[model samples]
Target: MATTNIWQQFKALIPEGVRVVATIAANNGNGTSQAELRDGSVITVKGETVNVGEKAFILDGEIKGTASSMAQYEVEV
Candidate 1:
Protein backbone atom coordinates (compact mmCIF):
# COMPACT_ATOMS: atom_id res chain seq x y z
CA MET A 1 0.00 0.00 0.00
CA ALA A 2 1.03 3.61 -0.42
CA THR A 3 2.60 5.36 2.56
CA THR A 4 -0.05 8.05 2.71
CA ASN A 5 -2.81 5.48 2.67
CA ILE A 6 -1.11 3.51 5.39
CA TRP A 7 -0.80 6.60 7.55
CA GLN A 8 -4.46 7.39 7.12
CA GLN A 9 -5.38 3.88 8.18
CA PHE A 10 -3.21 4.16 11.29
CA LYS A 11 -4.73 7.49 12.20
CA ALA A 12 -8.23 6.05 11.88
CA LEU A 13 -7.38 3.46 14.51
CA ILE A 14 -6.86 6.12 17.14
CA PRO A 15 -9.94 7.02 19.11
CA GLU A 16 -10.92 10.60 19.95
CA GLY A 17 -9.64 12.22 23.15
CA VAL A 18 -6.80 9.67 23.11
CA ARG A 19 -3.58 11.67 23.16
CA VAL A 20 -0.47 10.33 21.45
CA VAL A 21 3.05 11.02 22.59
CA ALA A 22 5.44 12.20 19.90
CA THR A 23 9.20 12.32 19.92
CA ILE A 24 11.25 15.40 19.08
CA ALA A 25 12.87 14.28 15.89
CA ALA A 26 14.60 17.55 15.07
CA ASN A 27 14.96 20.95 16.65
CA ASN A 28 15.45 23.92 14.36
CA GLY A 29 17.00 25.99 17.18
CA ASN A 30 14.52 28.72 16.23
CA GLY A 31 11.83 27.97 18.77
CA THR A 32 10.48 25.14 16.65
CA SER A 33 10.86 21.39 16.50
CA GLN A 34 9.78 18.63 14.17
CA ALA A 35 7.72 16.06 16.04
CA GLU A 36 6.91 12.70 14.57
CA LEU A 37 3.49 11.50 15.57
CA ARG A 38 2.35 7.88 15.89
CA ASP A 39 0.48 8.21 12.59
CA GLY A 40 3.65 9.29 10.77
CA SER A 41 2.70 12.95 10.50
CA VAL A 42 5.38 15.52 11.22
CA ILE A 43 4.08 18.34 13.33
CA THR A 44 5.84 21.63 13.94
CA VAL A 45 5.97 22.48 17.63
CA LYS A 46 7.01 25.85 19.01
CA GLY A 47 9.29 25.19 21.95
CA GLU A 48 12.85 25.35 23.19
CA THR A 49 14.67 22.24 24.26
CA VAL A 50 18.31 21.26 24.17
CA ASN A 51 17.37 17.57 24.33
CA VAL A 52 16.78 16.40 20.78
CA GLY A 53 15.26 13.00 21.49
CA GLU A 54 12.99 14.02 24.30
CA LYS A 55 9.35 12.96 24.28
CA ALA A 56 6.54 15.47 24.62
CA PHE A 57 2.81 15.62 24.93
CA ILE A 58 1.69 17.80 22.01
CA LEU A 59 -1.71 19.12 21.13
CA ASP A 60 -2.71 21.52 18.38
CA GLY A 61 0.84 22.42 17.40
CA GLU A 62 1.97 23.13 20.95
CA ILE A 63 4.01 21.20 23.47
CA LYS A 64 1.88 20.83 26.54
CA GLY A 65 4.38 18.84 28.58
CA THR A 66 7.63 16.95 28.25
CA ALA A 67 9.59 14.14 29.86
CA SER A 68 13.24 13.48 30.59
CA SER A 69 13.33 10.67 28.04
CA MET A 70 11.22 8.73 25.62
CA ALA A 71 11.13 5.64 27.83
CA GLN A 72 9.96 7.64 30.82
CA TYR A 73 7.21 9.32 28.78
CA GLU A 74 6.06 6.11 27.20
CA VAL A 75 5.32 4.71 30.65
CA GLU A 76 2.86 7.52 31.29
CA VAL A 77 1.23 6.98 27.94
Candidate 2:
Protein backbone atom coordinates (compact mmCIF):
# COMPACT_ATOMS: atom_id res chain seq x y z
CA MET A 1 0.00 0.00 0.00
CA ALA A 2 0.99 3.63 -0.39
CA THR A 3 2.21 5.76 2.50
CA THR A 4 -0.73 8.14 2.64
CA ASN A 5 -3.37 5.42 2.61
CA ILE A 6 -1.54 3.40 5.22
CA TRP A 7 -1.43 6.44 7.45
CA GLN A 8 -5.11 7.08 6.82
CA GLN A 9 -5.96 3.51 7.77
CA PHE A 10 -3.95 3.84 10.96
CA LYS A 11 -5.80 7.02 11.82
CA ALA A 12 -9.11 5.30 11.19
CA LEU A 13 -8.37 2.38 13.51
CA ILE A 14 -7.23 4.50 16.43
CA PRO A 15 -10.05 5.81 18.62
CA GLU A 16 -10.09 9.53 19.15
CA GLY A 17 -9.38 9.36 22.89
CA VAL A 18 -6.80 6.58 22.68
CA ARG A 19 -3.10 7.21 23.06
CA VAL A 20 -0.31 6.27 20.68
CA VAL A 21 3.33 5.92 21.67
CA ALA A 22 6.32 6.52 19.42
CA THR A 23 9.90 5.85 20.44
CA ILE A 24 13.19 5.24 18.70
CA ALA A 25 16.31 3.42 19.82
CA ALA A 26 18.43 4.43 16.86
CA ASN A 27 17.91 6.03 13.47
CA ASN A 28 19.98 7.31 10.54
CA GLY A 29 19.60 8.84 7.08
CA ASN A 30 16.94 11.58 6.67
CA GLY A 31 13.56 10.22 5.61
CA THR A 32 11.06 8.50 7.86
CA SER A 33 11.79 4.91 8.83
CA GLN A 34 8.72 2.93 9.76
CA ALA A 35 9.04 0.18 12.34
CA GLU A 36 6.91 -2.94 12.40
CA LEU A 37 5.54 -3.20 15.92
CA ARG A 38 5.07 -6.57 17.59
CA ASP A 39 3.46 -5.78 20.92
CA GLY A 40 6.82 -4.59 22.23
CA SER A 41 8.47 -1.26 22.90
CA VAL A 42 10.95 -1.94 20.12
CA ILE A 43 10.23 -2.53 16.45
CA THR A 44 10.08 -6.22 15.59
CA VAL A 45 12.10 -5.83 12.40
CA LYS A 46 14.46 -3.15 11.15
CA GLY A 47 12.58 -0.53 9.17
CA GLU A 48 13.40 0.73 5.68
CA THR A 49 16.05 3.44 5.82
CA VAL A 50 15.34 6.47 3.67
CA ASN A 51 17.77 9.23 2.69
CA VAL A 52 18.75 12.67 3.97
CA GLY A 53 16.88 14.53 1.26
CA GLU A 54 13.57 13.07 2.43
CA LYS A 55 11.57 14.05 5.49
CA ALA A 56 12.23 13.04 9.09
CA PHE A 57 10.01 10.77 11.16
CA ILE A 58 7.05 13.07 11.79
CA LEU A 59 5.45 10.71 14.32
CA ASP A 60 8.04 10.42 17.09
CA GLY A 61 6.50 11.24 20.45
CA GLU A 62 4.81 10.20 23.68
CA ILE A 63 1.08 10.67 23.33
CA LYS A 64 -0.28 13.47 25.53
CA GLY A 65 -3.87 12.05 25.74
CA THR A 66 -5.10 15.63 25.46
CA ALA A 67 -5.78 17.85 22.46
CA SER A 68 -3.43 20.74 23.27
CA SER A 69 -0.28 18.97 24.45
CA MET A 70 0.27 16.74 21.41
CA ALA A 71 3.99 16.11 21.85
CA GLN A 72 5.95 15.85 18.60
CA TYR A 73 9.71 15.29 18.63
CA GLU A 74 11.65 15.88 15.41
CA VAL A 75 15.12 14.30 15.35
CA GLU A 76 17.33 16.12 12.91
CA VAL A 77 19.61 13.95 10.85
lDDT of 2 by residue, 27-74 (tens): 433433433222544441233342322222323332222122255566
* TM, every model: 0.54, 0.21
Q: Which pairs of residues clash in candidate 2, taking residues 3 or more apart in a chain or in different chains?
A: none
lDDT of 1 by residue, 1-77 (tens): 55678788899898655455788899888888898876788888877563567788776676767854534324553
Off by over 4 Å in 1: 1-19, 68-77
Model 1 TM-score, 2 decimals: 0.54
Candidate 1, residue 36: lDDT: 85
* Model 2 spans > 4 angstroms off: 1-19, 34-38, 41-77
Residue 18 of model 2: what lDDT?
Answer: 25
Candidate with top lDDT is: 1
Q: Give the range where candidate 2 is weakest over 10 consecutive residues by summed lDDT.
A: 60-69
Cα-lDDT of candidate 1: 0.73
